[model samples]
Target chain A: MTEFIPPGTRFHPLPSPFPMKRGGALVGAHVAFETWGELNAARDNAVLIVTGLSPDAHAAANEGNPEAGWWEPMLGPGKPIDTDRWFVVCVNSLGSCKGSTGPASMNPSTGALYRLDFPDLSVEDGADAAASVVRGLGITRLACLIGNSMGGMTALSLLQRHPGIAHAHINISGAPRALPFSIAIRSLQREAIRLDPNWNHGQYDEVTYPESGMRMARKLGVITYRSALEWDGRFGRVRLESDRPDEEPFGLEFQVESYLEGHARRFVRRFDPNCYLYLSRSMDWFDLGPDGLRQIHVDKVLAIGVHTDILFPLQQQQEIADGLREGGADATFLPLESPQGHDAFLVDIARFGPAVAGFLATL
Target chain B: MTEFIPPGTRFHPLPSPFPMKRGGALVGAHVAFETWGELNAARDNAVLIVTGLSPDAHAAANEGNPEAGWWEPMLGPGKPIDTDRWFVVCVNSLGSCKGSTGPASMNPSTGALYRLDFPDLSVEDGADAAASVVRGLGITRLACLIGNSMGGMTALSLLQRHPGIAHAHINISGAPRALPFSIAIRSLQREAIRLDPNWNHGQYDEVTYPESGMRMARKLGVITYRSALEWDGRFGRVRLESDRPDEEPFGLEFQVESYLEGHARRFVRRFDPNCYLYLSRSMDWFDLGPDGLRQIHVDKVLAIGVHTDILFPLQQQQEIADGLREGGADATFLPLESPQGHDAFLVDIARFGPAVAGFLATL
Candidate 1:
């Protein structure tokens, strides 16, 4: 299983066994993953982790940072997704530039960045691609397939669409199908990117990406990721008069604007425009098996809901558990409380770690 | 009394006791006013009611649309200022256009409007102008001088700089000195107007008013005037989508935007641009009496504070009362609850009117 991989070692790229095609998009995987511990002989000791969107395969921690992956606190040596026990492998999803086949990678067909012509893709393709990695890596079974947010939807797809895959699924703060509000918000983000003049119909090959468009998208996304109360409490009426100290015009507004701008700027640099759109659209279009969950074939499931997660509220988690139960799968549910809103799944480690650790401990 | 001028009745030439000034850039006025009530022959039965910013000489529900000086509910027959009880004179303070001298009036020095060239008007100047009108109208004494918000500050200025010209003073939600937060907010509003491309340094004439800039200014003002909770409760995530039904596009968000737009549109039509800028600046620079109540001047003070007045909290009202008491004046304090906030004097007429009536009855 994946536990055979060294603990301190990170990037674990599993090349595809064969080529993959979806719609007009042809892709071959060079799946980069971050594995914890060693893969057992039967692979039953293995748990597969997947990141949502934008982040790289480094799902555990950076060499120096030691705390990244949006959910680093929940995955560590003694914590949940315990590196000391279960072999965990988190591979960057397909159609992402984080050491995976993506728009930024040269299209084998045109020998250029895929850009808009990369052809539309869905979450099913992402799940299939991930499954291919497990098979190519010689893992016949996964102990648990873990995913959060968009990644959670992919996990569900993997269990139902790909048979004899993972034995158990852990969905943390996600939905079987995208909420209408989520769809609308994502649509707006895409529109904002499309409206940027520099986007050039996704054609400008001068290497100057549509940073403005990306920044706007990030700003729009961050708004939903944060709570209004948090914004009011943190930056209510603060006017940083001398912020741009060197700049002549000292009239600055609330520091919150600067904070938001920072998030927008940073996100634009490390993320690909097309990948974000594709992932968001994938999340938007996601739904369950043929007839609700009865059609899906997962052996067991553990759904983790968070109270303050407006994006994937408690109802979404409950629906997942209910659907799995209806499908004759052993399902459990856990709810966590955190004011960090949707980001709470990534930040509420004190409660989430215990819940994750206890759940995995049983396995 | 203004009551003599019935509703729908327009005063010819608007009684410009304070001539309109057109100093090169704009034309504005210093309007005059009078009320219709029994003078009691002694003239001591007269009370001069004053307004803060933007209001003209018209105070009563005059014979016009019954909505004139923004304090119509408190000035009608048998109301607080009680047109039936006392002779009331509320003049359009100087540096205002409703028959008062301001940037919109023709400059005596030049043939054009004073416009940007209009000297930075002080609240003290506005108060002195009102005092001039009281003297011009041959009123020997005022039974009481009632002011609200900036009007309250203006009243305080009148009582402080001017001697015992008025016997009783009623200041509602007023501050003798402006708060730093208030100043900062006002500064931002002014900056928005000044930054407008069409503003031309505040010299746009030919009826091509800086409507857009003025709208933004009013929008900023409205945001600050009402509590944000009210915004979320009322507008929240409601959108004014494109006219086409079944349009999947996500359009304008937050009902507050539409709310602000509606308000700004109305204000842009009714109010002058320079007047708003000048009034805001005047408020920013406002200060009355000495450092504390120990140096203020007033005989008897009735200070009213509205609970929802976030801009000028209830404590500011308390400060007004305390200052009067320190100045050896008899002081009375009362709090009125209204969701209308700083604009409660205009909106919560039922509650506000009765409170004013009760206070006036005692006075």
Candidate 2:
């Protein structure tokens, strides 16, 4: 019912009428993935990599494309992931718009964009979609499963829903469930999008998009993703020093504001607002307690947390490790001191890479 | 010249052509203040209380009205302020819209609301207006000056601009200069107002106001004002759990969101968006360093900071105390440990009250 292209960035369609969590189903569903290295004859040497909110299936440079990906530093021939030793599978998340069937995709039943009509998704649903892709690749078991942030929640859900599917798991800067402070931050982001006059209740055309709302929301996101210490050390009330004195002196006063606005503009160009709303809500809905961890039958698990991460925080990672350990799993906790906050997993290659590599070596 | 009403809850007008910080002046400018107790015959026992960004001159219940004020807990007969022992003067800042000369006030030259046409203001300008009010009451020197947040900056500016005006000073949860983190937070809030389609560049009438933008901005403010630890302990993943499941499950899911939205709605009702933008920018521009503190002619200074304050961290308050001490003034630093964060001075009376009372007893 779904076509499967070759490895190295391909799409795999789900069976028709794919059921979702919270009582809803999606039709003509598919997932996009990219692979590195070769799959062993036994199909047991595959390492699965899940991404954060905005990243895509392109995790690193491949033979066809020399361009670097979001996690380029952690992947390569001799990098932490060690693509030479294992086949690395990176899946674009279920609700994302980057080469994936999401809110931007056409609805088979209505012949229109899914938009707000997309069914509510859970981390478990995203895991099921990724599982379908894995099974289609003729893999019975994963050598290792790794994820960061929201991806971390999906990794836990994957292990819970499909027990014994992975030999080892690594969760980086991920939470068992979204905290109240983070939920409040994301709720405001969604409100920013919905308040845009161009949003038109999620029915805007491409030319008249909710760009301002998305831009403002991303500005807020960048602020929360980094630590105050880091911002203080870096910006420190430095003026932007613009040449135009006649322009309105409201938004572009501080260097940090300019940096945030630049990042917001770049993000709004790539991300779909509806997809952001759905995925952010999905993160809020994610919950994996002792019972859920008890269902995960992995051999070894390593939980990595950054000290400065306010969104997920170090305590959430500790909870994950504790939950897995309490459920009779070999779980190790690695806490890192980095100023990058929740984005440390994506930025600090020196600290995060070694911990992930050391964990993979044992498995 | 502007008219001056009686001592209790009245307006003191400044001379014609009141100059501002960055050029441009306000004609027929006046300052609104409320007096508690009586100025001594010597005119030397008056306590001047400058307000934060949102508060008004109504610091406590008075004879005219029995309604409680914003800082009612801290300002009674035997409270930390000690109205029974000393006369108190609370003045609304220069650019605020609470019965003060601000964007909402009429411009004599144009015979219309100043709105966006209002001149830019600074902490020093606010201090000058309050100084004029004190002189209007025929008091040359104040016993003490107390301010918190933006008001603290104004008090410091007053000491720098006109030395020996106040005998002693107390700065609570305020920084000598606004940091990049706080500037970025406030910048986004202003952007929210400017981006509102109904804003119309701060010229909207009462009916078609930029209420959504102000509501969203206030939500952001509440997030930054409080600590993450407090929210985590108080509202960690608690759902609102409505009985009706069909009422658009977007914003009303989490209790935290509901809390923030409720505060935002109440703030939007009471605050003018244009004044918010102006005052927020002024806070960003406030920077008083060694050069400024060296001009202080006070005998004693007390600087209090909350450990959980992310906006104005304890380190900033420590800097103020250290700067004043280094400049040969008797400055005492009190670091508070409260989960209330920057808003601790407003919420936690048990801790902050004793510190202020003890310090005032010394003065």
Candidate 3:
């Protein structure tokens, strides 16, 4: 499948022979990024926005791309992140297929798709790539670093690996390490993809794309992305008005089932399956031991989470606060009661936006 | 695959041309059951157990069958159900493959496996079949009716459909209707089975089994069956002792993944995939609305659930208690603090056992 790159996404060439964390190197590689607003004369007013899995660098529309981005509600001028005051840079993680060099990219060495031949990707490698992009933009020190979900892991790695990279940090719905429950869920998701005969060891073409496997994986993800409370409130035993297809006896019957089917169908062809596998396994392998947080030297830290998020529970945010506080940073933990679960940071702007804005105002 | 029937399960012939709840009839049909203890001359001391999906009629070892049953710890001579005092009859759910006439059974008219040709099976049908077994044994009324998980739905249907059939009811981790979250989960499970090429419209045999699809479905079930808290407490970030398989890049790396893989492998071939699809869809179709609960006429009722249960959550059990209480029955809702989640009734018997025995003692 083709890589999903948004229009006007800028690329930053990495140093030749860039070393990967798990003993591999990439040559002639580049990271995809998009910027909103301009850096001040000092170049210290820049705020880097690292994203979660599946989001492109197109967080919000800029001069180059007028289309609304994924986090358009919170990233535009005078919005929560406020492009009027802060120059925001959002970079697609290194292993993503969204205009970034990943398994879907042609290997300079072999002139073929990397696929399974791609070296093992880790969250740390993503951190290094983001760091390189920040440096390439002529920013010596970011005013603040914002990371959401998987990017939270990357941010922590950045702070630990490259000290004094940022003055303050905002970790949203992320963990220092992968939890067992989350690992199990992702494991099943990868299993679903691999089990598809169409997957064919990642050699699948557009004609034989692993649509069913990707559908199942995406459905499982959508289920965990929200809380059961939200599901009950929204769809509660609501059956489809139309008759189920006679040929498929167990076809769509409930509204919730139809909702999931719609979601999975839209997603299966949009993202490269190989890139998903690599990024997902990278999370499972992430573990920033207890001491990793204490090594960071940021001035201030804000860890935001929602109570309904089972994927990254509220306690994980509290742990971030506690750990960063132990490192002598003025850390504050804010837990919101959003019913959207792990995806609340993206959808529940009413709850998350103010917290982020207030934290940035302090900086 | 073949039906997984335990030794010494007795069958009671159904009325010829047994009618199904959803527009079809079964010929030469039978309901499978196993008994422990003896029914008195008055038959008033008889107790009946309807089961969740995938359990056999042999709930406990009997004189005819010495093998330990699924609920062995909670049943027997001096166990929680206390067969020594009450003659206990456990019936295999009608649409299940464990010694019951399910999709795996041969059709009398066609002399071939029913498979997808089997009529739509509902929880009500299972209730009717269990009611038939009770009446066939010459028992006018049950001392107490016990239902666990899906069986709880069947037991509710029994009380509403067959008035005065059971004098008391004990619902363990059961819901009045299917929740949207649960329906979505089960729908995905059915989709997984149907998408497998080997399923071949439910014409799979031992040689052409849809093992991968079944494995994925079972793994999904196992993940939802237990709570995230239990997973964290049991295998938090524990890696496998052995190295991951070199051939499979996304193979088992963590202990939780290994646990799910082991669990799914043991379950795939044990139960027929067609039977699984039928039974799973039946639960998605089960919904006894607010008025349905009010229609039930029983003397005493007890609904038990655990706080950690996400599949059939604690509020659902409370709903059962509240609804039944409104129906003029003496009902008690007991929520236990078991970290085992939905499967707590099966594994955390220390808490579930006393509740069942206490309810039965009053009966």
Compare the candidates by DockQ and give the number of the best one. 3
What is candidate 3's lDDT per residue for B97-166, written digit by digit as tens?
8878989999888989999899999999899999999999999999999999999999999999999998
Whole-model lDDT per candidate:
0.66, 0.85, 0.91
1 or 3, greater by DockQ: 3
Model 2, stretches more than 4 Å misplaced?
Answer: A1-8, A243-246, A289-295, B1-8, B243-246, B294-297
Candidate with more favorable, higher TM-score: 2 or 3: 3
Q: How accurate is candidate 2 locally (lDDT)?
A: 0.85
Model 1: residues with Cα > 4 Å off, grouped in runs: A1-363, B1-31, B34-36, B63-69, B206-208, B228-256, B326-329
Off by over 4 Å in 3: A1-3, B1-3
Per-prediction share of native contacts kept: 0.00, 0.81, 0.84
Residue-wise lDDT of candidate 1 within A160-181, one digit each (tens)?
7787697788898877876544
A1-363: candidate 3 lDDT, tens digit per residue: 334888899999999899999988999899999999889998878999999888999998898799999898999889999999999999999989998889999999999999999999999999999999999999989999999999999999999999999999999999999988899889989988998889999999999999989999999999998989999999998878875733477888888988998899999999999999999999989988969888779999999998888888888889999999999999999999998999998899998889999999998
Candidate number with greatest TM-score: 3
Question: Which lDDT tens digits does candidate 2 get at residues A68-183?
Answer: 88899999899998988899999999988887788888888899889988988788889999889889988989999998899999999998888878988899998888888889
| TM-score of predicted chain B versus true chain B for each candidate | 0.85, 0.95, 0.98
With a 3 Å backbone cut-off (N, CA, C), the pairs that clash in candidate 2 are: none
Better of 2 and 3 by DockQ: 3
User: In terms of docking quality, how is candidate 1 classified?
Assistant: incorrect
Residue B137 of model 3: what lDDT?
A: 97
